[model samples]
Target: MLSKSISSLAKRVSSGLTPLRSNPEFWLAGTIPWLKTEQLGEKFIYSTTEKISKIALKKTSIKICRPNTLTIAMYGEGKTRGNVSIIKSEMATNQACCNIELDPELADFEYVYYFLKTQYNELRSLSSGVRKNLNSEDIKNFVIRLPQELKDQRKVAAVLSALDAKIDCNNRINAELEAMAKALYDYWFVQFEFPDANGKPYKSSGGKMVYNDMLGREIPQGWVVGALSDWIAKDKTGDWGKDMAEGNYTLSVDCIRGTDINGLNGKGAVAAPTRFILEKNKGKILAPFDLVIEISGGSPTQSTGRLALMTSESIKRFSRPVICSNFCKAISLKNSPYAFNFAYLWKSAYENKVLFGWEGKTSGIKNLLFEAFTTKYVVCMPSQHLAQGFFDFVCPIEDMKQKRLKENDELALLRDWLLPLLMNGQVTVA
Candidate 1:
């Protein structure tokens, strides 16, 4: 039952700094992964969104924390503060991170990480006064309680780590599967290699090609080139329903915002807030094959047209009818049966930075030029049969990915439910 401050258990507590961006030598041609507060929250961080040069590391206060070094966010917008993660490889962080190196003699590294995991809310509340920020002093002085025996700590950690390891494995498998699906799409659609009547890859087996003035390139016979708008059936802006049920606001829905799109696509956690709306707005409910695109809120490095493909499985993941936030639009393709083709088209456009050219700004927030993008951007539509073939092949891959996601969700639930009980000695590994 005895507890000690983190200062007693940690060998060192420190933070890193961002080097001067004005120096090209500091940022350009870098290989070292540099993390910011927004990158925290994952259990094991293997990579980062941004990296720094060795010159920056030497010239600045940044130091590469060893593997397993626990980093916590000190301050950020929204719920970015109090987020925590353990770097799986050598990495440097910004000033907003509170990095703690545990003393092997006084504490087990995994044990301490799990203990802090249960204190997320407490850590968030540590910030006080007008300037809300947690400093190194607060992290070092934070108290922790664990079994005195180091072996017992390891046992507890082993139990929790097993679940996390499984989840991590599933995520890796899912990533690989997604890559395969993308490759299949590229080969069949982009390369015009769908199977011909004889079951051979179309383009590779001397398939016919025709040149079109609109595309300024050769495409397979029967394929049509047209603007992005020709493929779109409907595009409607979303509504942010009332926060609470009252008057005509009787229907309850899970509101998906621009920030939540990637989460639905397995990139991160879905954090949509529930809202109450009028029953008459039921027509806005999202269904399978509907694509949601973010129209606003992009950063300098990112674009505003991030999308989410709605599948039957995706809809099933939500307990109630889902609605997009006002910052997004729900788009339905004109070709109902070939919806997957449009989804892949949008994805390819997004990955190629095509959305960057279609951005307009209002009040400093970047918004997608939805009308111009959908009305002017050109695309090549493959035959219905080829499109359907690609869809059939990718459906199983996506379904399997969804299954793994569901499993991870359940495993996380079990781990969270057992964490407090295990930490307090109410339950033992064996």
Candidate 2:
């Protein structure tokens, strides 16, 4: 085994640059995929949110990296600072990322990526400055121990990669299931192409239509125009209980925060904490089909209205009954049958950027005008029978998606448990 500084094992170590955003030519019709700290949660990245143009590349210090270059964030307030991801295509990054291009002969790229995952806290501690951020020098100077033989290093990486491979497979499956749900919602609601009495697409089969001044579109004759709030039966704000049990704080439950929405939805790992609250708040226990909506805490690039549907299956993932944090609120549809439908409708509105219009700034933090947003956003309401039908169709799909998610959590736990032991030579792959 040999221990060496990361700088010695690499061909180059550097950070990237962000082109001046005010310059229109730097961004218009861009083609090169650009990366940011926001895209670091994944293990392997094939694409990014924004791309850079040729002009920006030529005019600035920004440079695109080749495939397989390891990238890590230089800073974060929470768990992001030391997070790492490997790009699978040509890409450029912002100044906040530290990109490492390792010499293939000396260091196994995947091995180093996995090693760094276990060193998040240690790596973050290396940050220095008023911003408390990491620079390229800190990363290059970091030391790692690996098997002297290249083949041995590959063996360890292969074991860990295989585990992540399974998780990736699950992610692909979950994504497809999510798309299917959205397609069903769009067909039934947006296109009005839901199945008719004769089992044909409703709108296409010439279902009766009426023009409503509010919806500004022709909906089915029986379909009514209703405000979003009309469909909701209850709007209960969440409770943020004490972090530890205290006098009179005896009830124990898992508290989901605004950040845990993605993890609960299976996009990433959710680490919602267990909290102690008064027994009175037990009435707000999250039930199946109830939607947990993020009401606060959004970045400038993101919004505060992310949504997650609680399920009987998802609830089982927690140690106890779950409640959302103060940053979020739960909404129950007028009826359990319409729960899934309304959830889908809210998602459509969010994706259409409607939430952005309804958001307001208070103390520089963006907040959703929950009542105003819900009251003004109009939707062509589905009848109870149709809503029930959609609910029934989605139940099994949610079941399958959650099944894979639970498996992923277990798989990830195993991988994380093995990672450090494998890297430190406490455990061997072969």
Candidate 3:
């Protein structure tokens, strides 16, 4: 039954094509073996930093697809959480390029890309290989259902595309807002610039001033030196004694190694495909709005002690949970109004210190000790009004970010719902 269907589809495709048997380009000019799956980024196309020689490209028969073509990675490693992305660029040396040219009549490229991404897991399950690979034959043999009308395809693509376009716009807005806030921070804090009483620009009176050993420059008058521990609570006693029961509580890592920090959620929210969990460990269950810091294990001097704000939901889901391996989670004090900004500030300073301290070191992962973080430092405690004012100024940007994320999530759901339906003809474009 499958063979007959495939043969019929092949004949139909052949009939639609303008035959050119003699053209050399009609056949693939070259074949290449993918360098490795790990080399591919979340965006399609592996980085040139990991490129192999032209000789290596000839080892495999895979041909590159054009930019914006609908493609899929037939084999998936456990990495990427089963993601599928459209081809965004020309062929790379180490990737199994798509062989099938996209059918403009059958589907919109972006629509097809989203559909395939949604069905990524199903495709992976059908793929055969120790490393998980799907061949071109497998893809061609797979059936796709479509509405006979081009208008229907356009309609379906348009609906989904609008959401994606909105999401992209929100992302841009968020980026701009963040850039604005960072610029403000640099101007006031780093550059020591503030308005004088007469609204004239002055260095010392308008901004908080402080002396810094690191900078060898005197800062604004009101600024003071401090550590994260001063504003946040650090459970340094190392006592998780009673909370270690296996079933009663779960421990989670403060950070997931090899994952992007931007993707991590706090405030007791659980992101899908939770990769890290804690065994029984003695620690307080994290609370909502609590700041969680990755105290250990990132680039040794860089990204160590990175921080995130835990929502209330995350605390409920993973409270009493063991701290996952290779991470430490710290919660900020409830009273600290500036905890979020403080987290960012401390992270920046700590990361800078690490970079300076670990120059030329092979180990990127840094181990954070509780004593150093808790006992040694103080944090600037600006008045609640000031903190609130700062947050108010930036809240719109944060809202834009949240909106973008929500739109992306919705787009993902729609894409997933459409993939198998369109592929199987259950959902037609018309």
lDDT of each: 0.87, 0.88, 0.48
1-430 per-residue lDDT for model 1 (tens digits): 4498988988778998898889999999989999999988888889998989999988877888888889999988788889889888998899999988888877888888898899999998899767788888988899999988888899999999999999889889999998998898888888888888999998889999999998889999988888888988887569898999999999999999998898788887677899998899888899888899999998888899999888887776677789999999998887766777888888889999999999999989899999999899888988887787778888788788877877777788899998999888899866
**lDDT of prediction 1:** 0.87
Q: TM-score, each model?
A: 0.90, 0.95, 0.62
Which pairs of residues have clashing backbones in candidate 2? none
Candidate 3 worst ten-residue window by lDDT: 10-19
lDDT tens digits, residues 119-170, model 2?
8888989989998898888799999888998899999999999999999999
RMSD to true structure for each model, in Å: 2.6, 1.9, 9.1
Q: Residue 196 lDDT in model 1?
A: 88
Judged by lDDT, which candidate is best? 2
Task: Report the candidate with higher TM-score, 2 versus 3.
Answer: 2
What is the model-wide C-alpha lDDT for candidate 2?
0.88
Best first by lDDT, ranked = 2, 1, 3
Query: So what's the TM-score on candidate 2?
Result: 0.95
Q: Which stretches of candidate 2 lie over 4 Å from their true place?
A: 58-61, 75-78, 360-364
